[model samples]
Target: MLKLIVNNLKERKIGLHELNSEELTEALHYAVANQDFALQREIGNHFTHIYDQTDEIPYWFKSEYDDDVTIINFGQRDKVVDWSSVTLEDCLPLTHSKHKPLLNGFKNWLLAVSDPLENGGAVIKTSTVKMRVEKVLSLIDAILLRSAALQLSLYHLSHITCDFWLSLFKAMSENGPINGVYDFTGRTVELVKAHVKSITQEQVNAFASKYPFVIRDIAEDDLTLHLAKQERVKACCWLYSQGYYKYGSSFIATGNGAVLAILLFEGKIASPSLNTPTSTELWLTEKERSTEYRPFNTENSKTSTAEATINTYISMAKLINTNIFKDNASSPSIEATKALSVRKINDLVILKPAGRTQTLHPDVVFKLTRQSFEFVLKFQQDILDA
Candidate 1:
């Protein structure tokens, strides 16, 4: 078994070599988070022992597999199936067989109750069984890790926008010494790609093998969060240009890797060029706007086009820069409601709001208190005028 384990690891070693540095971190999360296999055996064994004495078979007490049904002297008999390639249904020729699966179950129950204790009823020892538990746990971890690797299901990045993600990547990707989220001295896409290269799978596998229970499966929650962010990205594209002007750049790369600001198309053009040493803005046209968009990392649902997604972003920028930023405090209630909606719209995060529902469009919705709704509008106006 040890040789088998070692060989499995060896064969996978080459495949893991291709993991980027960040991908490796997520992979490690999968590898390290699960319960030991010993626990499963202990739990399974306990069930067996309990059934041995009860004699009264619980309705829930079902064997791993099923056998055929029977009709015998006891009204209806059941045939119990042991480990075999043939299923219980196939084992007994229904035309001739008088017994069914129920009979086997009844018999087992009778056996259990007839002798709750065996020859003075001593406890069974299981220390030897534990020796291989760690190995089994490790093997299970590997199986899960491989599954995740094959499917790309273990991305654990925070629920931030891609613009922010890009910025962080830029900071971490640079050459030379790095420190935390700040690495301004280095710049360029190549630097970020290098950091991405740092991610791998084996590191995740080793860590996941340690905890075999709790973190057993890839987190579907994270995927939902990502999908929500994707929706936001799409919104930024489709909203009022996301506040852009002049050169028409769609996003802003900034903060020495600490932050990435996605410059959406602003509704109105600033007096000067969109980007100067101090300012950068993105631009968009009317066709790029969106009403309501879906969330990201979709495990369930139809796929949306990237172009459609971009439209929302553009609309957001234009709306903010024009109506919201440019001194338009027309609907303080509406603006606050928009932000509240943006922050938690059809996303993974479960946000339960108090009060009434504000329906901006057929696709967009908002749940907010009256006061909070007003505050959002005022805040949006401030951004526009600022």
Candidate 2:
């Protein structure tokens, strides 16, 4: 029956999409029974393609593969969480039914576990747990909306496999909807291990770093580290202020604008050359070598946290004030902006404070720093043009 249909499709006597769910199911079973995995895969692919073109998956097709396929076929009336519209209240279980937790017993188990070194044997904060849960849900919602997976459920610790965790991590990393959350692929292993609940160590070790969770608790003593990170950011600002830029096809592709500069500032890597790549060259390089794109080696920008982001920006502002404004100017205050806004006014750049939960590019803070203003203007018009 399947062979006859395939021949019909080849002869253009019948459309692949025109096959009913019963026919497709029989084809799927026939392919599987005959150990023809390639045929089964092609059938799934064609199913997806049909849905994509029509914006509707056949009801029978959805019923058969709802759990097996990546693209979810949610009913029109079924409620789906919208991360963009989420508020503190929307995250509350009492307020929203779809606002579900990722792991079932992990939170309670983690709370029971004690950390003698921190918070007088308290392992984590209630507020921090709430935030992490919200974040994880947001990520799941984003993944679901993009049809990354059908009916993804991380709620049952026993049901989740190592492959599921890795696939989830990969999806989060590649998906555009959750880039604001963190560099999911870049720093997945650490974050996943950090948020491990009641799951056994052996199970956690199975993934070998590709676990799950954006649920790592923020350390109580993070202020000290924040101060040190700020100093490094300050050094980066100083480099930009001095008109020194690092560009190379190899190293430059490792991270985003700010991360590259920070790596250069720390002397962890050496500068490629004094010559900066032109904007056109930069664009071409990004297009050509996307795999080596932006290495996020540092812990600061790898995790999703407002403190790391705000600290870097504040440090940049402070550096600008000290270097250019004689440490007395209020125009470039050390305050993290309440709003993420940037605009240029002649030689000076006006930047507003980033939100408490905001994540921003370090280059924005560096370029908009009062001290780096003249250099950026000159670099743009003269250096690149020439």
On lDDT, the candidate that comes out on top is: 2
The Cα local distance difference test for each model comes to 0.28, 0.34
Query: Listing every candidate in turn, what is its Cα RMSD in Å to the true structure after a full C-alpha superposition?
Result: 31.4, 25.8
Report the Cα lDDT for residue 386, model 2: 82
Deviating ranges (above 4 Å) for candidate 1: 1-196, 209-222, 225-355, 358-386
Where does the lowest 10-residue lDDT sum fall in candidate 1?
Answer: 265-274
Steric clash count of candidate 2: 8
- Tens digit of per-residue lDDT, candidate 1, span 1-386: 33333234346643334545664444444334544344333333344564254344333224421333211111233322221211122233312233232223222322222232321343323331122222222221222222222221221111123343223222222221121122221222222323333334453344335322212232454332122222222322322232322224434321111112122111111111112221111112222326474333223222222322222332222221122221211111223323322233324222223444332443333433566678878798787788
Alpha-carbon shift of residue 5 in model 1 (angstroms): 99
Best by TM-score: 2
Cα lDDT of model 2 by residue, 316-356, tens digit = 22222121222211122223222222221101222223454
Q: Worst lDDT window (10 residues) for model 2?
A: 267-276
